[model samples]
Target: MMPTPGFPPSTLNTEGTPIWITDLAAGDPNHILHVVRGIEPAEALEVLGAKQSLIQACELPDSTPDERTSLPAAALGIEPGTSAALLAGRIGEWTFVYDDSGFTYDDAATKALSADGRMAATSVYTINGDASLTYAVDGEQVQWVNIDDLVLEADLPSMPAELRAAFEAAGTIELEGFESGEADRQIAMRAACSLASLALTLSVLRRVPLLVVPLG
Candidate 1:
């Protein structure tokens, strides 16, 4: 599958669906600009609309690949079997999203995600969607909200073991607590900032242990 710039190599892993979402899926008009550039949650909403509720009805898997395509729309025409393989990984609570579209895999993989109750959304949809696919501050569901710092910190490691440890040891992890007020509104934005910082830090850590890099 074709890859997009500025995405993690894991995005290419057909078995590991991308986890970094954008604001294009279900956010309000004002927040539409935040969606990650590639994943097309908003576009899917345009095509699926209220039908999105169907995602909750499926039997999703635990994990999925995280690719780097431009938008969900990019994967719309991919093969079904590839989609199926990709979706098969997203069966349970351990599902994934991408910075771009899920085009590397086949259509069946995408369908499998829908079939298993897993969800897909761009950063925009996660942040701006009327309903967010991410977890709320108190673990509630907010279609367009961002995940709390605590949630991101807690979840990042679990997203992938080797990757998580690598990041942690590298001291590149940057998940700060939510602001005192307006937690939801700032979650996505904060995550974006923290992630960007983490990326830069990780680059250095990957080479050598900085003071922040743990010995674990």
Candidate 2:
């Protein structure tokens, strides 16, 4: 099991960090996959503030219990210096999606520079859990152009031998049970881990200039 030499971060590419991608499950109506992303801390707060201010400004009605929209920390799913994404990563929560649907993580990338550390622009992401997702920058959400639609996708070379084998194996048919169906479970478990690793690798490599390879 060789390790993927993770994707490049902002420092490597004159452009920026690479992105991870995967297609929606079979027969998924959208025929799309989500590229998990993060956002910088300062920018994340700025975006949130703008949305809060805007939403707070609107009144409910002319006279019927006309309460204003409150941008309370608890209300917006924000904390004194934390967010839903942070909570979900550290401790398994019932939900990871925010009101707008962003998943946050402390070290969501293979490299420290690439992972969101409460400041980097890629710390918080808005996932639609399908193709065509958005991420948070403070409060405003931004969308990633589909990697499939990118001219870049065509240029990406095959992932290194170890990683490519791992990715493909995840799609392999489950082996029949020898007993408690443990064989099939093991296959799925390994596959899930492989995919996670692949995502991190893709996120960094996707930024390489003049680099492209089709995984489809």
User: Could you say which candidate leads in lDDT?
Assistant: 1
Q: What TM-score does structure 1 among the candidates reach?
A: 0.22
lDDT per residue as tens, model 2, 11-130 = 111111112212101111111111222533222222322232323211111121112211222233333224221111101111111112232222222123223422111222222322
| Total residue pair clashes for candidate 2 | 31
Clash count list over all predictions? 68, 31
**Where is model 2 more than 4 Å wrong at Cα?**
1-82, 87-110, 113-157, 172-192, 195-216
C-alpha root-mean-square deviation, each candidate: 16.4, 17.3
Question: Candidate 1: lDDT over CA atoms?
Answer: 0.26
